[model samples]
Every structure is written in structure tokens, then in C-alpha cells.
Target chain A: MNTNSDYPKRICSTTGFPICRSAEFFVKANAVLGVVFLLIGGIAAILIALTRWQAVHLLPVDWFYRILTLHGINMLIFWILFFEVAILYFVSTTLLKVRLASRLTAWISLVMMFVGAVMVDVTILLGKADVMLSSYLPLLAHPAFYLGIILVAVGTLIAVGNYFATLYIAKKEKTYEGSVPLVVFGATAAAIIAVVTLLHGAVVMVPTFLYSLHLCPQPDPQWYRLLWWGLGHMSQQVNVCAMVAVWYLLAAITTGAKPLNEAVCRSAFVLYILFINLASAHHLLVDPGVSAGWKIWNTSYAMYLAVLASMMHGFTVPASVEVAMRGKGYVRGLFGWLTNAPWRNPGFSAFFLSLLIFGFIGGITGVTLGTQQINIIAHNTLRIPGHFHATVVGGTTLAFMGLTYYVVPLLWRREYILKPLCRLQPYLFGIGILIMSFGMSFAGSMGVSRRSWDIDAGGSIYGPTAHLFLALVGIGGTVAFIALFLYVGLTVGTLLFGRRIAAGKSMEDWGTPKVLSTSPGHDHVAPAPGFAGGATVAEAHPTQGTMVLAVIFLLSFAVYYFANWKALADVWPVR
Target chain B: MNQESSSGLECPKPGWFQAPSGNERTWIGMAVIWCLILSVMMPYWHFRGKQNSTGEAYRVKPADFVKRVEAFVKVNTGEESLVEDGIAPVVPAPPGEVYLLAKQFFWFPVLKLRSGETYRLHISSADVQHGFSLLPMNMNFQIVPGYDHVLTIKPQAPGTYHIVCNEFCGIGHQQMVGKIIVE
Candidate 1:
């Protein structure tokens, strides 16, 4: 062990990952804050879902938009970003075996972020900022709302700055080798996206704040929408990058999985940093004043690279797991690897569920809905929320929740409370999200409004079909809400009162995460077979199982894409 | 204490950036094909699809468009009616470049169009931005002020179609409904 802990730290016994005092404090603080926001946002999500369900229109028109704004900020921005910051710190410091770049700046950023979040929520709850998540132009909110957003953006920028600096320091100190590990590279992609996204927030919000203060002219709505989505939709892409990174990380941590090829994984990350945020223009597909060429280039040509990157991940992640399982003596048939996966572990289950939902539901629907002509149908409808719920909620949120289980024991040095409930958490949540996503998408296809409080629109009559599917939305929301409730409760309980882990349990028995290489079959001899009692995995496993799964995924994607096109064609006869 | 061997079974030497395996190349090739397919699908849909744009827009102030809409309502051959929600009075228009306005809470100058006859529908917002969402049909677009969105539509089979503002314009956004009576 590199017992060079003059900087107030100790090497973790179980995982061999370092536990720097400053890094641990920041990680715990941000993580706790992340959970706090998740609880609030998850509650708000249930309320919003219920309200959208016509049979039980839970909130009034005003409260619906209000809670929605809070939900959007809290879940998408606060919860995800805070947790990602922690992840960044962990990947930079512990994984690379280096100290955080600067502890003071990280603390300040956290405080600023917390204060900003509180301020934004306060404004929303006071009903002074019910402009929905988009908060479109000419419809002004309190200045604090924009300022709050700006502060969070600035704080996040500072954190990203720290991440880069930490990397530089790690390189200077000669920590690890050969391109900084796949997970760190993924986090780096996310951080790069964050820089671009946050700058947009600053550009738009600063002027908006000034406008609210009567220090500037009323900003153009079209211009605001353009700049705003650079932050709005792109921020979610940042989450996508981080979320996929977490998938790789958790798979490694839990199942001893590594990418089938590290170079491929790194290349995918590169593609993401280059082209993922281009898909943000899908938000502008329906808006006038923006040229078709711009929208087409963005939504079609450039954005496809990001989708391709995700596709690479979709294959490699599970392939990693399958290869890992096969190496561990599950090398029977094609699916023996899959059958032997650690479904009982919350960490493993969450990663798997995240992959499935993201690929099957989120990825397919996103590409279809993101198409230029197709956006006309899905853009402002409940379909928009439906698609995102599957991606950000089902994919990113679940991945984070799954990761929390490992984080608790690993960083907090605490064993999980309610072990049985922890195991059930991912499956139950996954099921809930599936139902919720279906209901929302179905209701959306029927033309249920996205931000509307009343599907009936003062008894305008969208027919019982709308009501029926919306009721499905209701039932699904209820299921998902219950599952979310359990998650929040279990997580909070585990954090506050979980038992301490045994000594000498750094990451030894923690699923033996072999994330360093992804060589195929089982030529792996651990470099020196008997050095650390490491077993040599000796059977050559065929990777055809993952290939089959990939084909199935592609078929599902094609079917959904064609179905939307058919729907679009049916809307009007050819000119 | 944990050993360094666990991070990787076959740990790459300190600068291993490339994967010699062929699986990665196959994956990359597949990704490139997908990109090309997605790229081509859009223009194909744009030209070959029924959902193609009318290539229509002309800048106009919100006030000027409202006046133009009002003038269209005056000269058009259609009965004056209220949209389904009975919220806003809609003056149905004839089959020219029909002017329409979307504001905080409602859409104006709803159209009464002939079945299977293409009508140029010009929609703009008086304030902020609103959505011109035709339900059941599920055709929708944004209504940005100072910019006109001209959609050419031929409603098949005569029926009353409700237009809901799907965008978040304001608190009364849900109540912003307009109707098109296809005759």
C-alpha cells in the first residue's frame, strides 16, 4: 500500500481504494444532498404523474406546473449533478489513487450549489416561478430563479475545473497507467459536456436575470429557446454520459466486468464529447425561425454519432458482464453467462436494469422521437416527458440508485440496512418505470398535452381513449411512486443507521471487480497465477450471446421507428 | 489489504491505448452504418414523406398578424363559432394563407376548411411562444412570435379537430384551445 497519507487520508482495506478525508467529506456531503433532492423530486414526480392521470387529478393547474418545475430542477439538475460530482471526485481521487485537487474550492462549490438549489425551490414553491421547466420568454419569473440557476451552473463549472486539475495532478504524480481508466475517461466526457452546457446557462440566465431586474430589454423568445436548450437538453446529455459511465463502473464493481475492448470504449467516449449534445436541437425541431438545415444537421447527421456511441456501450457493457461471468466458470452455453449473473445484488441488478431500460425503452424511443418530422408529433406532447422519463428516470436515476448501494458500504464504510429490501429495490423500481413509461407514451400518442393540468381541457372531450391510457398512466405512476418511496426510505435508512463493514474488506470480497482489461475468452492467467491466490479462468467462451441480444435490440429499435413514421404518415394525406 | 492484480486479469502495460481485437472494429463499422442510415432517413422523410414542410415563413409583428387574422375572419365564408372548450371565439377562415394567432391562453381565427383541399395555415404567437397541437391527428408545431409557421394541411374526411396549446406559455396554457371544422 502507498501509505503516503500525509494529506489526511487512509487506504481503504476492503477495496484498496484510498479514502481521503477531504474527498470523503465532499463525496458524503454531495451524496447526501443528492439523495435529499432525489427524495423531494421523486415525491414531486409522483404528484405530477398522478395529476396527469385524469381520474385522480391530484394538483390544481397552478400547483401542477409548480411541482413540475421543482421536479425538473431537483431530479434532473440537483440530484443527478450532485451525485455526478461525487462520482467525479471518486473516480479522480480514489480510482486513480490521488488526492482531490483542491478541497476548499470543492466545499465552496457544494455550498453554492446547495444554496442555489434551495433558492430556486423557494421561488417555485412561492408560486413566483411557475413558468414550467422551459420557462419560455416574455413569461418572466422571479430574478432569484434565474440567479439560482446561474449559481448552480457556476458551482458546477468550478467542480469541473477541480476535476480537470485533479487529473493533471494525478498525471504529474504518475498514479496509474495507460489513458486514466475507462470510468474516468467516461467521467471526463461528462465533464466536458457540463462545461459547454453550463456556459449556455450563464449566457441565457445572466441576461434573463438582468431582464427581470429591468436592466435589459425583454429577451427574444426564439433566442432564449435556442440558448436555453443548449443548457436544458444538453444537461440531460451530460447525465447520459455520466450515467453510462456509472453503468461501466458499477458493472465492474459488482460483477467483475470490464469492457470487451478498452480502446472501443474510449473511442465511444470521444464520439460522445464530440456529438452527443447536438441532439439538444431536437428540442427546437418544432420551433419556427430555425432553418430546417440546422435542425436536420443537428437532429440527424451529428446526433447520430451520440446514438452510435450509446449503441457501442449497450453492447460492450453487457458483453463485459457476460464475458466476466463466463470467465468465472459459467461457461456453458451462450446464455450461461447471463444466467449466472449476480441478480441478487442490488448493485448488479441496478446496472442491468439501467442497461435494459435505457437500451430497449429509452434509446429506441429517443432516436425515433428525436427525428425532425417525428418531433412535430412527440415534441410538446406527453411523449416528450415519456421518452425522457425512460432515459433520465429509468436509465440514469436507477443507475444512480443502484450505485448508491455500493457507495454506502464502500465510501461511507457502512453495511447496508434492510438487505432484503435492497435486493428487491431495482426490480420493483424497474417494473414501476416500465409501466409508467408505457402509460405516458400511450397517453402521449393519443395527443394528451405535455404541460396541461387537465386532459379534458375544461371538458373539451379528447374521448375516453385518452382517459383510458391516462388512467394507465395513473396506475403506472402509483406503482412507480411506491417503488420510489421504498428506494428513498431504504437509502436514507442505510445511510443514517447501517452497520459498519468488517475490517480488511476494502474491495476484496466486493465482487472482485476486474475492470482493468476486457480480453476475450479465458487466456487470462492473472499475469502470475499464484501471486495473490488468483484463479486462472481457462475456458474459451463464445461471445455470440451478446451478439444475439444486440440484434434483438436493433430489431426493437427499427420496429418502433417505423411505427412512428406510419403514425406521422397517417396524420395527413400526401401533398 | 487488496492486491494490485485484481483491477485487471491481464493488466495492459503502462501505455496500452489500442485494442488489438477485431470485435471493436466490427462494432465501429456497425456504428458508422447506423449513423449513415439515420442521416439519410431525415432527408428522405423530408422530401418523400407526407409530413414535408410547406417551405413557408414571412416575418410579421404580433399586432399586424392579429389584424390580418381579423381581416381574414371578416371576408371568409364561414359561420362564426366558439371552439369546443367554449373558451375562445374562433372565426373560421377560408382556404388562402389563413392567418392565425396564439397568445397566453387561446388560439384565434380557427379554420373551417374543405375536406381534401390544401390550406396554408399560418400560425404565430402574440406573446411568448405557444404550441399549435391538433389532437387525435397528433400534428403539432411551435407558435413563436415575430416568425410565422406556415403549415399546409388537408384534413381528410370532414370533422371537428381540436387544437390544444401543448407548449407552456402560461398558467392558462391548458385552456388555450382552438378548433378546425372540416367541411
Candidate 2:
């Protein structure tokens, strides 16, 4: 075993797949995509908000719906997808101390997904379809849109396959023993959910495409409804799982903190697995035909479990933060660390603020709207967007941004270009979201419907209030847009122009260097019996075991896809 | 080598309802001041709990609504045509009574009067995504249309709750909202 002083300061000697190289590529890819998608989506959201405020219908019916659809799909879906892929790369390589299964396959997946995304954008812009992001049945878009969606799904499936393959290879090589690293285990769960959700997407989209081409009479609305939700709701569950994993990773990076109780964090993830699928029924609370008992079971009681998971994380993560801060001697009062802690630490500040915003706005709305009776009133208004923005944008997006600051620098072995600007972005974005969310809620309460072209409906009494609130929403949206733009600029500038570190210095060594010799916990502990003993032998051999597992998983997909195709063919004959 | 224990000293408690120290205190003070201003301006808020044009108050008693729903369902469902028509056959509202349901997407009312008299409809959702809309009357209320709770309206002048599903509900969501016509 190598002594602490003899630990390698450079890349691992096993292969060309060093952690820094892997992290650098992944982080750069994510940052570029993250900034680009945010700009496109943010600008669209701002335009919509501004038009609503001025009481001018700048977006035609087609343009309005298209913007809304792309705004959500790009930011909430594409941005998260790219970030999760990058995070997966970092986790598998850096945390698990392994290389990717195949760099070629990873690049292929990225190219296909990018192609699919471009197709979706082009289709939406051409006015061939404006079905909105939900893409509810009976509202048809061009066939290209459906094909684009399929390609994206296929790309993600390939990526998931690569992830498992990489894991199998690592385990065979015995890089780590017994259980997987917590972060990778969490990501594996997300990948599993993604596979199931995407399969459901094929079930919905393949038929919808055929129907649009006059191949079938029409897809059954009820069937379409169920299938779409299986995709929609499950994808969201993937987001939740990934977001939680990021929180743990951020904690590790920022303060070298781990969850006080690993069991609690693991259980939180387990609860999400059990409950997220059932909670999709909350979206259908006001819908007809579903049994009242079914709705109650799924929407009300079942969702509370998922809610519990979120709440637990909300408490536990902050507690970990508190403990870490206290270790740093910021011990004034119970909540004093919150004030005395380094607000300039972009990773720390963003995660904390994101958690706060999500809990207060998103959590409250989620529970309230899940009620069977209450859903009747709140089903499809702007309030729906407001609630999700709190959860998805304020929660997931902010976490990703926070993680990026540390992950990018560490991966690339470079310093941030504008470190101070990075610190300021979170506050600006958080405040803007607060104003926008509050104004939206107020407008919704006053009965201002969502997705409408005009706030003034002739003689409606609430017209003036709606107009005013929409204006406030525009102002808030503009602030958020500016803040996001600044973030993108800073991140990209850092990657392209920031100072490169010396080859010999580790990333951890360069930044605010901790004195390893004098620190209380600096002593190197020997690895337990099984992991270190097995590593050398396992690394020397090429095993066919991982190949078999990959074959099994791939076969399952092929079979599912064929079965789905057969079902569609039976419903609508090719002739 | 005994060290002094920091845990033994009792932390000073701030007064009940008083702000804490530092930046937090300023935030609290601002919140309190805003509350005071709102309370003073409450009289001019104008729309808070005002009675509808039919001289009936907007708020409905939960117990009364339960009793009324029970009575209406029992009497109306007794007839085959009411079931066939897919409308809530009208029953009787107690003199000057209103029935309200807080829904996520749209309002559902079982008007409990058999008499052909018009009443005011003031509807709302508690959280997000609501429509107090009666499609037949060409009326809509976008509640929390952007971010908050929303309330909608329909006057008894129309005689029936023209259940219109205003928002896009995945697929079957449109079929959820139904109506009550006073016979």
C-alpha cells in the first residue's frame, strides 16, 4: 500500500482514463450546454412574461404555444438531461475510481441527442406543431417532432447502457468492493427509472405518430393519458433522484462533509423509488373516469411518502451543512452559521437557497394541489408552471449550477474567471424567482388563467389585477434572465481563458490548500481487507461476466420494443 | 486539563414576536412594517369576502354544503333522466346559501334547488391551476394563472353550471368538469 506522502499527485497509471481528464471533458460539455439552453429558454420565458404584462399579444397563438413548449422542454428537460449525463461521468470515474466503459459509445450518444434536440427545435419553430410541452393527445404535431423525441430517448438508452457496462467492468476489476459508491448507486437508480420511462414514451409516441399520418383512426385518449404520464411522471422522479445525489456530492466537495447518517440518506432515496411513480396521479386529480378511490390512494396518501423524502433531505442536508460550518468555527447560534458562513462560496450558497425556495413554494403547492377537490380548480393555470419552476428551476437547476462551479474547476484543473460574479449570480436569481413566483400565485388566485393570449376578457372584473401581476412577473423574469446570462458568461469565460494549473499540482492542492500534515484527520487509514487485496488480480484479467449482463439488459429492451411495435401494428394495420 | 463547557450557558431569548439580531432582524422589521401597512389598507382592498350580486355571501359553510350535497344526490339521482342527461338535477339551496368546491382545475357544484331561480357563482382553487369557468356562458377566471391561487365566476343568471374544462388536462382531463342546471 502506498504511504500518504507517496500518493500520486498526477493522473492514475492504470489507463488514459484519469479522473481529471474525464471530469474536465464532462464538465466542459455540461457547462456549454447548460449556458446555451438557459439562454434560449430564459429569453423565451421573458418574452412571454413581458408580452403578458404589456397586454400585447406579441406571440401569435402558434408562436405563444411553441415558445411555452420549448421554454419548458429546453430548460427543464434538456438542461437537466445534459447535466445528469455529465454528473454520471464524474461519479463513475472520479468517485468510483474507474474509466467509462467506452468513450466512443458516449460520444455517439451525445451526437444523437444533440441531433434529436435540434430537430425538435426546428419543428417547433416552423409552426408545424404547437402542442405545448405536455403534447396531450388529439392535439397533433408534425411527424418530425415525434421522431426527434424517439431519437433522444434512444440516445439516452444507449448512455444508460454504457453506464452499466462501465460499472460491471469496474466491479469485475474490483476497483471498489461490495456495495457501489453512494453517488453511483443513486445515479443507477435514476438510470433504471429513465429506462422504464423512455420505454413508456415509445408506447405513447409511436402510436401518436402513426395516428397523425392517418395510419390509425385515432389513439385512445385514456390509453394515451396513462402512457404519457408514465413517461412524464417517471422522468421527473429521475430528476428528483439525480438532484438529491448532487446535494450529497456538493456537500462532499464544498466542506468535505458526508451525511451524518448514511442510512437516512439511503432510505430517502429508497422512499423516492417506491413513491414517485404513484404520485403522478396527483396531476389527474380533477380528471373524470378514474375511480375516486384510486385518485385518493395515488394522489393524496401515496405522494406524502415522496414529500417525506424531500422534507427529510431538506432537514438532513442543512444539518450536515450546520455541522460542517461549526467545524469551521462559525459557531455563533443555532442558525448563526447561515449568516457567518461564506456566502461567496457559490456551491454552498446556491444549494442552500435552492433548497429553501423549493421547500417553501414547490412543496406547499405540490401538497395543496394533490388534493382531489383542490385539483379541480388548479389543474392547468399559470400556477402549474409557477409550482414546477420552484421545484425544477429553483431546486434542480440551481443545484446543477452550484455543482458546476466546483466540478468544472476541479475537472479542468483551472481557476474560475470571475469568482466574485459566480458568488453574486445565485442571489440575483433567487430573489428574482421569489418575486416572479409570488406574483404568479397572486395572479392565479385572482383567476388569471394560463396560456391565454389576452388578460382582458371583455368585462371580467379581475382584468386589472391580472394585468398588474403579469407585469410584475415580467419584471421578475427579466431580472432572472440577466442573472442567468451573467452566470453563463462567467462559466464559459473561465473554461476558455482561466489560468491553467501546474501539471504536478492536484486540484485539491491548488485551491485554498489545506495543511495535510497538521490537520487532525490527516493520517492515512489503510484500506479494509477485501478491496485492496482483490484490486491487483482483478485489474490483470479480462472477464466475460460483464458482457453477459449487458446482453441481458439489451435483450430486455429489444423484446419490449418489439412487443410495443406488435401491439401498435395490431391496432393500426400498415395497409 | 478540564475544559470549560460551552453548552451550560443559557442562550438569551429574544422577546416573543421580536426580530432576531443582524441582517435577519432587518428582514423581520421590514416584514412587520409591510404587514401593518396591509392591515391599514385592508378596508380599501374592496374584494375581500364581499357578497355576490344575488345578496348571498361568497363563503359557504362546509357542514351545510355536505348536508346539501347529500340531500341533492338522494333526490335528483332518484330520477332516471337526471342520470341520463349527465347533469346534476337541481335541488334546493337554503334561503341565501352558496355551495363552493375548492378544486385544482375547475369548479364542480351540485346546485340544491329544484326551483328555476338564478344564483351567483364565485369559485376558486386553493393552490395552483384553477378555472372558475362556465363555458356555455363564455366566462373564465385564471386563478394564480401565473403562480398563485386563482378564483373564477359565473352568475346564476345562466341557470346552470356550464362545466367547461378550461385548462389542458393530459387527455381525459377535459371530461372531468360537469354541470348543474336549475330545473
Candidate 3:
């Protein structure tokens, strides 16, 4: 393939990562949009949290709902998708060592997505679209609201097409030999799920868009919910896939950790593509007109396959890190690898934090809550948000944030502006999210309603503990908000005015290592500067610490799972 | 860990479909067992577990269901609630199935039931989708229009449990609250 001669290309001296002008444009464009949405959402989060806080009760009812709508749409939908779109461009171009395919199409999609996101935000801010993120039908919003979502989804679909085309181009041009990199494979899964999810968006939103115009009859609420979750819940699965992909990418990039087994990891990604979206049916388990067999089938056995995929990831990621650590001969005890793991590196720390919270909080809670009978107590409570916030905000968002640390210095050619603050950011954010999610989950278990602007409703009862937990949510949310502001401020400051790198290439010190081509030898540390971060022990074994962590995770899962059942049994004692 | 760092990258390819290592197989086996156990729990609970959410279903028009609930409430408007305002008085309904109409902002009437009586409670939404969440007890189900969900439940303890609409219906959705008083 001939270079267009118009597009600039360069390889980074520090990381050896390729930078294509066209791909960089897409990355910067989408990433900036993601940040913009984050800012809007973060502000809205504070207001909503304050309102939900019983003592303060900041925003009025309508404003509370309106702000909550903006918060959900901006953070969950717009911000994450925009960032993932950016990731797709990066994967197809820089990772594959190929120029981005179809620059014009990418630009068009970017513009359309931006316009749609703006349109949705404007509709919500104007107080005409407070139907919450679901915007359940018969509760009409402005026609523009539906149109905005449709445009965003359609735009994302187009971008996904461009991603596939780029992959095809990579293959045709013989960018690399045999299978693509693990990062690329995982990204491929995410893109595949994204296309399917966007289609579901079209399936529901098109009719609702038309209904808003009085051009079509309203679909049955049950039917709408069935289809709509294919969009709503499945879209988050895209994030899950992306987050996992990024996890692998970060592990390799930061720690030089080889995936413990490429085949198993790839199989896990394949499983996500095949069965993850079906987990959406768990949302409808309590719904009437849906059969028991359907609910049980979807939630119980089939969805477990997806859960298996998540479990595989939960194992392989940390195990891979352990392999890397043990390769450097850190095997002193069961936790030697963990002890030697990079704590100061924000890139590593954030990813590690994400993995922990996502599994313990999100994964265990998700499986427990998704259970057919167990959903009766958990569904439509704050636990729903609690579960997803762990997955999305704590897991995926943290990963993305971590990835950005490398992107700024390596891709943007600017050193991170506030390194000390950057190191502390993830811990602060992770702690805040921890408190918020647990507080919400415990409160929800106490029967606090979700999506209700007020918990202290007329005729509905709540215990004293519920108010305390709500207060915790408010405080945690405030802390998270401040952390988010710091992140955005630092990120923006870095891009604009951070020190420009002057070819400060090192003596094979800390930079991008070569992509591993063989199964790792646990005893031999690679002769790389960052690879041997003070190897402390003699006898080398991989993932000993990880195995212990896995055991702990399993025990926690068992305790939480049976505890829910115990709670259920307490309601109706079986003799 | 790969050797080349800081410059000139080599796009290396490893054994793509390598067999699972020892730890990998062990974890996979554990996962399989855990998954099967969870699945078994579902069937076991559905068969013998008393907290099974799956129950009877019936179809009813919103017009008729609302009328039945209104009549039931009219007859049983004897014991006023001390805890909350605007609540219609509660009294025990006779055996068999009873009606609960879910509309814009409330359930039609407070259901008063005996603690051990297994009454088939028929619930339906009058307008859109609502949720009948029995709080404190932590029992919930979707109330959909045109589909009456008949739940055969025996309230375990004699107490007042709030029935709140957990699903988002509309602007006044936050206010939709009812009560289930078990005597």
C-alpha cells in the first residue's frame, strides 16, 4: 500500500509505538469528547448525590431527575463510547502498525456522534427529557431526545464498520504474521459486541423515535424492555470487553506480563462475543409475560458461560502479572509477586485496582443479583447501579483512565503534568467508588429504591440504616467527583502545557518492551530496565500470589452467593 | 518478558492456541464446578426453595382490574394506617385471589392478609410498566399492562410491609407506594 504522502507518521522513541496522523486525529477527537462528557457528568453526579443525601437534599425533584438523566447519559453512554471509539482507532492503526483506513468515514462518524451527544445533553439540560436513561416508552420525551440517541448509535455503528475495514486492511497488507496481538484480539471482540449492541439500539430507538413523532404506535412495554435491554445492558458488555482488552494491553505495556495462556484468554474473548449479551435477559427475570423457562435458561446456565469468561479474565490478568513478576524471580512466598508488583506506577495501580473492584464488587454481585429468584430482592434497587458502577466506573473507567496516563506521554509526546497527584488519583477514585458501591448495595439490600428521586417517599418505609448509607453515597460521590476533577484537570493540563519530550530516549531503561513471542520462563527475568524491579527472591514460581487471590475471591463469592440465598430463605423458612 | 525495549519494535507471534497450564486447568475446573453448583441451586430452589419468584400468571384488562380493586378497597376501608397519610384503610380480604391495580402513582388499595394464608395476589399495571416491590420483606415483581401476575405468597410474619413501585413509570413514579398488612 502506497502512503497518501499527505498523512504524517512517526514512531515514538520512548515506547516504539507507531503514530499515524489520521488515527491520532480520531483518537484526540474522540478522547477529548469523552473528557467533555465526563466533565458534564461529573458535575451532574455531585448535584444528584447531594440531592439523594437526606440532610442536604440539594436539587429540587425535577432538577434532580433532570440532572440524573444527564449524568447517566453523559457518563455511561457518551463518555465510554467516545473513548472506546478512540481505542478502536488506536488498535487498528498504532497496534497493528498500519495507517488508519477510510479517514473521511471516521471523521464523519466522529462529527455525527459529537452532534448526537450534544443534542442529548441539551435536551436533558432543558428539562424536557427526564425519563431517566431507559426513557421507558409512554413516558414521552422530546422527539430530539430519541433522535439524538439514534444518531449516536448509528454513528457508533459506522465507526465500528471502519474498525473492521481497518482490520481487513491490516490482514491484506500483511501487517503482522499469524494471529494478531492479544490486545487486538480482545479489541476485535469488543468491536463485534459493539456492532450487535448498536443494532439493538436501532431496534428499540427507531420505533421510539418514530413514536415520539406520533408516526407509529407505541410498542408493548414488555416488548420494549426486552428489546431495549439488548441495547442498554449489552452496550455495557461492550465496555466490559473493551475494559478486559485494555487490561491485557496495560499488563503487557506496563509490566511486560505475557498472557498466562493465549488460547484460554482468546477463548474467553470468543465466549463474550457469543453469550455475554444474553445476560441482559436477567433484567427481565421478574417481568411478567416472560416464561420461567426462558428466564431460567437465559440467567442460570447460558449466562454462566459469560460468567465463565469473566472468571477466566479475572484469573488470567492477575496471573499474567504474577508470571511477569515471578519471571523476575520474586517467589518468596504466596504473595511474593503481589509484594513486588508496581504500586507507584499509576498505570499499573489503576489497572490492578480496576481488576480487584470489578471482580469482587461487580462480578460476584452481578452473578448473585442476576439469579432468577435472587433478583426479586435485588432488582430495581440501588444494587443495580451499585453492581454496574463497580463494573463500569470502578472497572472500565479506571482502566481507561490508566491507559490515558501512557497515551499522554507516549502518544501525545507530552509528559504528565502533576506526576505526584497522578499517582494518588487512582487510589482516591478507587476508594470513593468502593464506598459508594458498597453503601448503595447495602442500602439497596435494606430495600432502598433505585431511580426514585427520593427514598423517603409517601407510604414507603425505610429503616434508619438506609439514611446512613445514603449519606455515605453522597460523601463517596463527592470524593469521586473531586478525584474526577483532578483527573480531567491533570489530563487537560498535560495535553496543553506539559513538558514536550526532546528525544530523551534512554539506555534500554523504562519504555515499551518487545511483544513476547514465546511462553514465559518463570525463573529468568528479561534483561530490560523495568523488567527487573529489584527481584528479591531465589526460587521462582508464577502466579502463586494470584492463586491465593483467586481462592480468596472464590470464598468471597461463595459467602455472598449463599448469604443472598439465606436472606431469601429467611423470608419463607422451609421445614 | 520480551528483550527489545525503548526502540525498534518486533511484532512477535507466540503459540496462539497453547494448552492450559496447570494453574489454568485447576481454575477452569473450579469455575466449572462452581457454575454447575449455581445452576443446580436454581432447580433445587425452584422445586423446594420457598422463596421462588416464579408463580401463577393471568390476563386481565386494566379497566376491570381497577374496578375490582376499587370495590375491594371500598368494602375494606375500616382500619386506617397510623404511620402514613392518604392511605386507604386496610382490612383482610376473603380467601382465594384478590386484585391489586397499579397505576400512575399508587397501588389501588392496601392489601391486608393473614400471616399464614396462601392467597393468590393478582397484580397488573393500569397504564405502563410498574413494579410491586414489597419492601422490608424484599419481595418484588414486574406489573405489566394487560398481564396479571398472580403471585401465591404466604406472608411469614404479621407486620406492615410497604409496596413501592420500584420500576420507573413516569414523573409521578417516585410517589407510587402501597402497603401489604399481614395479620
Residue A189 shift from truth in candidate 3, angstroms: 0.2
lDDT of 1 by residue, B44-143 (tens): 8877787854335668888888888788767764443534444343444445577778887877766667788777788888878888888678887878
Q: For model 3, how does the per-residue alpha-carbon lDDT over A371-421 read when each residue is reduced to its tens digit?
A: 988888888889888898899999999999998888777767788887889
Ranking of all predicted structures according to DockQ, beginning with the best and ending with the worst: 1, 3, 2
Q: What is the interface RMSD of candidate 1, in Å?
A: 4.7
The DockQ score of candidate 2 comes to 0.03
Candidate 1's residue-wise lDDT over A1-575, tens digit each?
Answer: 33334567777886666677788889889988998998899889889888888888999888999999999889889998899999998888887778898989998899899999999999999999988778888889999999898889999899999999988887777776655777888899999999999998899999999999999998888889888989998899899899988998888777776566666677788988888667668888877767777888888637488888888888878877776766666655778778767788888888899999988999898889888888877878888778888999889989998888888788777777778888898898888888888888888888887878886774555888778878877787778778788988887787689777677765324344333354566443333333321122111334668878887887788888888888888887522
Q: Which candidate's lDDT is highest?
A: 3
In every candidate, how many clashes are there?
6, 50, 1
TM-score per candidate, in order?
Answer: 0.93, 0.69, 0.93
Q: Can you give the DockQ of every candidate in the order shown?
A: 0.43, 0.03, 0.42
Q: lDDT for every model? A: 0.79, 0.57, 0.80
List per-candidate RMSD values in Å: 4.0, 16.5, 4.4
Q: List runs of model 3 lying over 4 Å from the truth.
A: A1-7, A301-303, A503-540, A572-575, B1-14, B71-94
Q: What does candidate 2's lDDT look like per residue over A60-100, in tens digits?
A: 54466678778877776677777777777667765556666
Worst 10 residues of 1 chain B by lDDT: B1-10
